[model samples]
Target: MNDPDGGTAAMALGAAESGALDRDAADPGHRDRFLIPPARGGRYSDSAYLAGNSLGLQPVATRNRLLEDLGEWARLGVEGHHDALRPWLPYHALLTEPAARLVGALPRETVVMNSLTVNLHLLMVSFYRPRGTRTRILIEDTAFPSDSYAVRSQAVFHGLDPDSTVLRARSADEVRDVLAARGENIALVLLGGVNYLTGELLDISAITAAGHAAGAVVGWDLAHAAGNVPLRLHDWEVDFAAWCSYKYLNAGPGAVAGAFVHERHLGGAGPPRLEGWWSTEEQTRFEMAPVSRPPASADAWQVSNPPILAMSPVLTSLRLFDDIGMDVLRARGMRLSGYLYELLEGIGADVLTPADPPRRGSQVSIRVGTGAAALCSRLSGEFGVVADAREPDVLRMAPTALYSTHHDCWRAAAALAALLPEVS
Candidate 1:
C-alpha cells in the first residue's frame, strides 16, 4: 500500500464494523437496532460513514442504554423519577465528571442541558451583557447557518441591530483586525472551535486572550469540534461555550446539548439568565414556590427539567469516551485525519482544512474543483463514500475516532479518485 492505499486495512475494519452494526441495526430481531440508511444504491454498507462532522454513528452501547431506560420505567413506575433502577434524581450527575474531563472543564462549570440554540440564547442572556458602547459580537463568516440565525435573533432580543452588532472574521487576520479596531464595542466574541465547512480549528486560547484584551467576553460553539479536539475551557479563561453531542460526540441525533460556564462565574447565586424551575434551588423544587432562584453553577442556566430520554444516549456514548479517554481519541483523530489529508493530497485534491494539524480537528474539507458536490454525491450514491458536500464545492469528511478506522480513509480517497472523471 502506498500513499493512496496505505490506510486500507484500517478503513476496511471500520467498514466491517459498520456493516455488522448495520446488519444489527436493520434487523428488528437483532439485540438493539438503528438504521444508518444504506449508501445511495446499497453499493456500500453505511455510506463510507465519513460525515461524523454532521452526525456520528450510533454507539453500540446506545441501544442497550435505551433499553435499560425503558426497563427502568417498567420496573419503577412513577418512582423512576427519584428511585428508579438507575436513580433519575441524580442521573445527569453521572455524566458531569467524565464530561468535564472530556472538554477540560471543572465539574461545577459544566452541565448537560437544552439544545444548542437554546443554550446559546441562555448563556447570552447571562454572559452577553453590554453597557454604554461595548455591545457587539464577533463570529466567523463561515459559521453554520443555524448559528448565524441564533446570533441574529439574540441581537434582536437585546434591541441591537444585527448588521452592526454582528462582527465577522473573513480571515484569521481579519479577526485580529476587528479585535484591534472595534473590540472595545464588542461585548462578546463567539466562534466555532472548528469551522463546520472549512474544518479550520480556531485557536480558542489566543482568541480568548484577544477578546479579553479588548475587554470582550469570549465563547464558542463546539458542535463540530468538541469530541474531535482537545479543549481547556477553564484554562483558556473562556466566559462560556456550548456544544451539541450528536456530531463528533456520537450521542445520536437530537441528543441533549452541553454547556460550560467557567468556574469564575459559578459560585455566586447563579449568573443572571432566564428562569426555569429546574434551575431553582433543588431543595425547594417541589415546594410550589412562585419564585425561581437558580442554582449556583452552570446548572443554574437550565430553563426546564432536562429531557431525560433525549440525554440517555449521551450516557452510553460518554462511557465509551471514558473508556477510551479524550487524549487517546484526540491523538488518533489527528493522525487518522492527517492520513486522510495526505491521501487526498496525493490525488491532487484541494485541501480546505487548515494544513496545520494544530489548527485542524477530525474533519478534512477538500475541493474536487467545481464538481466536488457531485463527487461527494457519487461517493454516497455510487461509490459508497459517506462524505458530505458544502455549497459551491468542498466535500467534508470526518473520520471519527471511536468507530472510524485508518482504512476508511483509503477507501474514501480511492473512491474519490475513481469517481472524479465521471463527475467531471
Candidate 2:
C-alpha cells in the first residue's frame, strides 16, 4: 500500500523491522559514544534498552575519566586538593559552565552540588518562606515521592500541617485555576518540568509567570526534564530548579546533582540561605572568619565541599551534552519517541504519554493492566527489551536520542506484540 508521501505504508508508518533499520541508517544518532548492553534472552546480541529515564547507559568516556580522578587521589593523597590535575578545590567549577549550557542558565546562576532532594531543601531554605495566611505550597498530583516527602517535611519544619499546607493539582489547567483562586495563600509553586510517570512536559515559562503573578515563588524538579528537554531557566525567570544526573544526564547512580537560582535572587540582602565553608567567598574561605561572606552567585546555595569522585562522571556527561547540544538531541528525541508511540498504538497498547510531541519527552508509558512488573521482567529476560514498571500497572520505555535507535523501538514493539497476544 502507498502512503500520502508516495512511500510504501510500512516505510511511512515505520511499522516493519526493515523500515526501522532503514530509518536508523538514514538518521543515525550518537549511539557510538555509549556502551550498549548485551541481550540476555533474545536472538539479537544487544538489548533494546528503553530505560534511560530510570538510569542512563554509561558513556564510553566515563571509566577513563573516573580512573584518572582516582589516580590523582592516590598519587597526591592530601595534597590533591590544590595540586591535582583538575584540582579538587575547584573541580566542581569545571562542571558549572557545561551544566549551565545544558539547562540554559548563566554560569553564576548554576551550581553542581549535593543530591536532588538536598538541593531542593537548600533552595527552599531561601525560597519557601511561609508567613501568615500565605503559607500553602502548590504541587502536581503525580509529584515524585521524594518531592512529596521534601515539600511535606518543609511544611512541617515551618510548623504547619502538611495536609493543609500542600495543595495538589491534577493538571496544568488546574494549577492555573488554583493560582487564580487561592493565589494569595500559596507561598510556593513546585512542579516537575516533566512528569516522571506520564512523560508530560509542562510549560515552564508559562507556569513560572503564572506563579509569579499569584505572588508565589516558583521552582522546578527537572529530574526528568534537564537533559531530556530544552530549558531556558534564566530566560524563563525561574526562581529555582534542581535535577539529578543519573537519569537523562547519564551520570552514574546517585551522582552529584545540580541547582539553579535566578540571578535576581543571588547575593545581596535577598532571602537568607543556609551557609557553610563552601558558601563563603573562595578568596576568604581559608581565612576562617566567624561571619560568612557568600558570593554574589548560586554558589552561595552550596553548604558543603563537593565530592570530587562523584563530580567526575557528571563532568564527563555534561561535556558530552555540551559538545552535541540539547537542541540537536531534543529534535531527534521527538522523532524517535513519535515513532515508538505510533508502533505501540498500532499494536493496540494504551499509552499514557501525550500524543502531541511538544507535550512529552523521550519516555512513552503504557497501562498494562495487572502484572506490570511481571510483564517488564518478561520483556527484559525473555525478549531482551529493557523497560521499567511503575507500581500497579504502568510500563515505561524511553527511546533516548543519544544512544537509542529506531531498530531498538522496533524490537520493543515486536516484543510487546509477541508477549501480549490478546492486545495484538
Candidate 3:
C-alpha cells in the first residue's frame, strides 16, 4: 500500500535490497564533515548513526574553531575578552545573523544565550503573566519534560496551583478549540514545535493565531524543530520560542541555546524581566551603572556573559547551516526521513512519527513489538546501528540530513529486519 506521503513499502524494500536507493542518494563527501564514532569490527565502515534527535555528530571543524579561542585564552588571559581574535566581549554576536536565519527571526529578535530551559524561564519571566482568572498555562500532553516542569514551576512561583492551571492538548485541533474556549482564562500557550518522542510536528501558525485571537500569549519549545525543520517564528507572530543547539544544530552536548522574542516585545512594550550584566547595553555595560538599560532586543533576555568555549561550536554549526541553507537541508531531510519510514513499514514495525512531510522532520520513530529495547540494543551492539528506545516498546531512528545518507537508512532498516526475529 502506498502511504499518503507517496511512500511505498514495497518500493522502498526493493530499493534497499537492490542497493538502488543507496546509490542514488549517497553523497560520499557530505559525510566527511562529521566525526562518526568508530564501530566494532568496522562493520559498515561508518556506523549507521541515526541518533541526531538525541545528540548530533560532532562537526570536524568544531575542534579547530574551539582551539582558536583556547589559544587566545592561554596567550591573553583576561585580555582575551577584548584583544583576542573573535574577542570574548562580542563573541555572542557571531551567532546572531545565521542563528536568526535558522529560525526565521531578525538578528535583533534572536539571541544565543543559556541552555534551552534557562532561556524558556527567562522569556517566561517577561512574557508569562497571570492575573485574576487568566492564570493558567496551556501545553500539549507530550511536551518535553523540562518544558512542562518549567511551565508548572512558573505557575507555582506565582502562587497558582498547576493541577488546575496547566492545560494539556492531545492534537493541533484540540489546541485551537481549547484556546478558543479558555483563552480568556489561559495566560500562556507553550507547546513543542515538534513532539520529541513521536516526531509529530505541530502547526505553530494555526495555534499561534488561535491563542492570539483569544488574548493568550503563545510560545514554542523548538527543541526538536530548530535545525530539523524550517521555522518562521517572527512571521508566525509567536510571542517567544527557545531551542537547544546540541541536537540537529550539532553544537556538541549542553551547548549554548537560542531564544526568540517578537519585535513587538523588544522595546518599550517589553515586560519587566530578570536583569543581568550581559542584558544591559554593551557600550554602557562596563560602566557598572546601577541602572539596567537593556538593549532593545532579545539580548535583553540574556542573564550572564556568553561562555566562549561553549559558544564556539554553536557558531561553527550555524555557519555550516548558513552555507547549506535551510531550504536545501529541509528538502533533503524530508526525503531521507520519508525513505526511512517506508523501510520501517516494510519491516512490519509500526511507525509513530507522522508520515506527512509537513508534519514530521528527520526522525522516524517505530514500535517494534514488546522487545523494542532489546532491538535497539542489538541494533547497536550486534549491527553497529545506534538508535534509541523510549519506554516500553518505541525505538527512534533519526537520519540527519547533514551527515546521514540514504545508505545509512538502508543499513539501519536491513539491520532491524535481521535483528527482529532474534530479539522477538
Candidate 4:
C-alpha cells in the first residue's frame, strides 16, 4: 500500500513512528505532571489523549489541593468563612492575581467568578448598550451555541427582535467590513479568540481596534483561547472578555470562569451593571444598607459569594499556568500541532484548520464528511486515540502542550490511516 505522499505505507509509518519517538525524547512536555488515562483497546497501556480542547486531563496536584479545602470545611463548619486555612470570606481573592497574570490584565481588572455563559450575560449587561440606531450585536457565524443564545436573549431583553438584532459574520475580514459599513447600526462585536470548530485564531488586537474605531463595544469569548494562546486583553483595550477554566487551563468540568473589564471602564461614570450583595465594597458589605456602593474594580461585577469548593481547582490550575507561562506552552503547542498537521496531510485527511501557525491554536480539526462520531469511536476502541467529533462532519484533535506528545499525534494519524485506507 502507498500513502498519498508516494511512499510505501508500511515503511513510511515505521519511519514516522521512529521520528515521533525521537521528537518526544528531545522535547518531553509536562506529561509526567498529568494523569494520562489507561488505554481501552490498543496494545499501548495508556491512551493517547487528543481531546484536551474539550476537557483537559487532571493534574497530579489537583486531588491533594482540593482535599485540603474539603478538609478545612470538615474541620471548621460555619466558622470556615474566617477560620479555615485559606479563609472562605475572601477566598476568591486568592485566584485574582494568578488569573490576571494568565490573561495579561491588572489585578483590579480581572475577577474569577460564575460559569462562562453566566459571566458573558453579566458582562453584556454593562457593555451591550443598544442606542437609537446602533441596536444589533455582531458575532461569528460559527460562534458557540451558548454565546449565540446569550446575545440573542440580550436583544430580546431590550425589546428588540433577535433575528434583526444579531448579525453573524463568517470571517474576520467580514467582521471588519461590517464594522466599517454598518458601524452605526452595530451596538457590540462579540467573537471567540480561537474559533471552536475550525481552530482559527483571530487577530484580537486588530479587531478590537477596528471595533473601537467604529464606535462599537468589542468583547471576546476566550473559551478555547485563554490558555491555548497568549492574550493581552488590557493592552488591546478590549471592552470586556470572559473565558472558561476547564479546557487548556485543566481546571476540571464547570470550574469557576474568569472575566476582565479594561481599566478605562472600571468605575466612575462607566456603564451601569446589575448589582447584588457581593457587588458592594467588601469594607462596607456588612453594613447591609438599602443601596449598594460598588467598588471601582472588576470585583464590582460579582453578584454572589464565591463558591470555595468549586474555586479550589481553578486556583490550582491558574497557579500552574502562572508558573509555566503561556509563551512556553504556545511555542510547544505549535510544534506538536504542526507535526500532526503534516501527518494528516500525508494521509489525505481534509483538514479544516488553517495551515498557518500564527492563525491557529493547539486544536486541529478535520472534515470527516459524515459518521464522525462513529469514526471517533473506532479510533478510541481500536487504537486508543482519544479525539472528539463535532456532530455530523467535524473531528477535532488537540495536542495540548502540557501533556500531549509527538507519539500521541503519530498514534492518531496512524489510526486514521488504518480506519480510512481509501482516503488517498
Instruction: Give the count of colliding residue pairs in each prediction.
Output: 3, 0, 0, 0
Clashing pairs in 3: none
lDDT digits (tens) for residues 1-424 of candidate 3: 1133222433455455556344544553267898998654326666889999999999999999999999999999999999999999999999998999999999999999999999999989988999999988999997888988999999899998988989999888889888878888989999999898899988889889989999999999999999999999999999999999999999999989999999999898479899888989999998889988999999988889989999999999999999988988888888888878877777776688987889998899977657777777777877788888886788899889898878778878777766555444
Q: For each candidate, give its TM-score against the true structure.
A: 0.89, 0.96, 0.94, 0.97
Give the least accurate 10-residue stretch of model 3, judged by summed lDDT. Answer: 1-10
Estimate every model's Cα lDDT from 0 to 1. Answer: 0.79, 0.92, 0.86, 0.92
Clashes of 2: 0
lDDT ranking, best first: 2, 4, 3, 1
Relative to the true structure, candidate 4 reaches a TM of: 0.97
Report how far residue 66 has shifted in candidate 3, in Å. 0.5
Segments of candidate 4 deviating more than 4 angstroms: 1-11, 422-424
TM-score rank order? 4, 2, 3, 1
lDDT of 3: 0.86
Query: Can you tell me which runs of candidate 3 are displaced by over 4 Å?
Result: 1-15, 20-29, 422-424
lDDT of 2 by residue, 323-368 (tens): 9999999999999999999888876677899999999999999987
Selected candidate, larger lDDT, 3 vs 4? 4
lDDT of 1 by residue, 236-294 (tens): 99999999999988888888989999988886554678887788777788888898766
Candidate 4 has which clashing residue pairs, if any?
none
